[model samples]
Target: MVLVYGHRGAMGYAPENTIPSFRLALEMGVDGVELDVHMTRDGEVVVIHDFTVDRTTNGHGYVKDLALSEVRRLRVKHGFGGKWGPVGVPTLEEVFREFGGRTRFKIEIKRGGDYYPGIERKVVDLIRRYGVNAQVVSFDFDAIRTVRELDPNIETGIIFIGRIRWFLDIARKLRVRWLHVSQDLVDPEGIEEAHRSGFLVGVWTVNDGEVARRLVSMGVDDITTNYPDIIIKAIRGA
Candidate 1:
């Protein structure tokens, strides 16, 4: 079966990475959700995309520079004209507590290693504490490597935008079972190649029904998208 994950929680329908967005994705019947994480100065893990809160929220300053309290004060800027109403940045723990059992999670570590020392450990600790089904993934090779080091049992994935084979060596070193590539890379040959190499392929940000159908036919293991409902319907041919 081809699993569908909400990229930043059905971002096409709600504010990306907010609780409302995640909840909406769940309502739409996504198999899981993919969200980005950054650590506050106080060592709290908050969910948001950019390193700075300027783009998505009515706030300023880097996430690393702000304390958890400071992050809580900023309301997320909604795309649907305040339909989500005064949404605040949520902590990873908060998300886990509320929705952990409800859906799987693809937790993307925005920065790890030197940039966010011990972040891998923090995320692993949360996953363990919450006992949720989740995978740690990142664009940074070292980050997911650190995640593997922190907990070998935890599943990890490499995210990149390029040819499928470009990250194979790194994926091998990390021993990751998932290779999450950009939507542009989805093809029958690449999917077959990845499967032959003992890795499950995951494609990202696909919204069009035709494209979704193509990926499903290509034997993709996972599809991450801004619109899970559309992809769900597309795959089911509804």
Candidate 2:
């Protein structure tokens, strides 16, 4: 069966990256969960997709500009696929503790701007120290490289926002375990190269039934999306 990742953890059901979404994904029977990690001012590995809380949270400001305690104070938008609830933002450790060994975690580190410090090292160290290496990812080459340096055997993938030859070069040089590409950026030949290079290929944010089925037909190793029920069913020809 094609491995199905809950893109931001059933984002279609709950606010993405929040505990509600992640737990909900497991309930939905997804193969794994994907979320982003951003560092708060207090050196906490918080689960949030944006560099700031402006978009998803009721508060405003960069996550790096806020403390973990302060970030926790703000309420996340309704992620329950209906009305909002008491659900709130969750730290990476909280998530790990809650979902560890339950499902795979594909953590994408948000390393935008120069404000985030120690995030790359801390994220890698925490996952490894806690033995959750199969559960991490990042668009930041430095972050990915740092993880590889810390543990060469760590399973890591490089996420490309858009198609670029440099990503392939970096993946090759780093011996990354997989290549995560945005669905629109996919090219048949690029995926073939990745497969030939001995790496899994995962496409992200894929919600359309047609695209999901098409990618499955393309023999992708993994598919990350918001609607696991619809997409996974489509992948299975259900």
Candidate 3:
């Protein structure tokens, strides 16, 4: 069976990356949750999608410049538009503490203009401390490589916007076992080739029921989306 992961925790129903969102996704029977992480000014590992708080939160500032206290003060705005109550941005530690061992977590390490120097180590440390079933992934090849260096036991994957041939070589070099591709770039032949090369294929941000079923038919190992319930129903033929 293909695993269904809530893309930023059922983002279609709740604010992306907030605790409320994650809770909702878990309640909907998702196999896992995917979230992005960045380091705050004080070196705290915080969970929010963008490099800045402008898009998802009430406040406006670059996340790298803001302290954890500053980030916590901002309320996350609803993605699908409704007056949901204030939702504070969550720390990586808080998430692990709350949901650890309950489900799988796909933590994507995000970088803005430059890489977060020690962010990988901090993330790895948290995973070890909590003993959660988690994997660290990123668009930054160096970041995932750093993750591998920090802890070989912690699983890592590479995320790319479009199809790229060199990713397989990069994955092999980093000892990565998973390849996260954009939904449009996945197909049966590509998936088969990835499997032949010994990598699990996961596609992102799929919301259409028809597309979900087609990808399932194409043999995707994982399907990530903003609506876990919809994907679950599509996969189960409900």
Q: Each model's C-alpha lDDT?
A: 0.91, 0.80, 0.88
Stronger candidate by lDDT (2 vs 3): 3
The C-alpha RMSD of each candidate to the native structure, in angstroms, is 0.9, 2.1, 1.6
Instruction: Name the runs in model 1 displaced over 4 angstroms.
Output: none
Model 3 TM-score, 2 decimals: 0.95
lDDT of 2: 0.80
Best by lDDT: 1
- For candidate 1, list the clashing residue pairs, or say none: none
1-238 per-residue lDDT for model 2 (tens digits): 6789998898886788878788878887888999888898878889888888988889999988899999989998763544647668898888888877788878887783255777777776677666763645777777777777777876888888877354777888877888888888887787787777787889888899899888887878889989888886787754
What digit string (tens of lDDT, one per residue) describes model 1 on residues 1-238? 8999999998999999988899999999999999999999999999999999999999999999999999999999876986777889999999999997999999999989689878899999999999999999999889988888889999999999897887778788889989998888666787788889999999988989899888888898999999888999989754
In model 2, which regions exceed 4 Å deviation? 79-84, 112-114, 164-166
- Per-residue error at 175 for model 1, in Å? 0.2
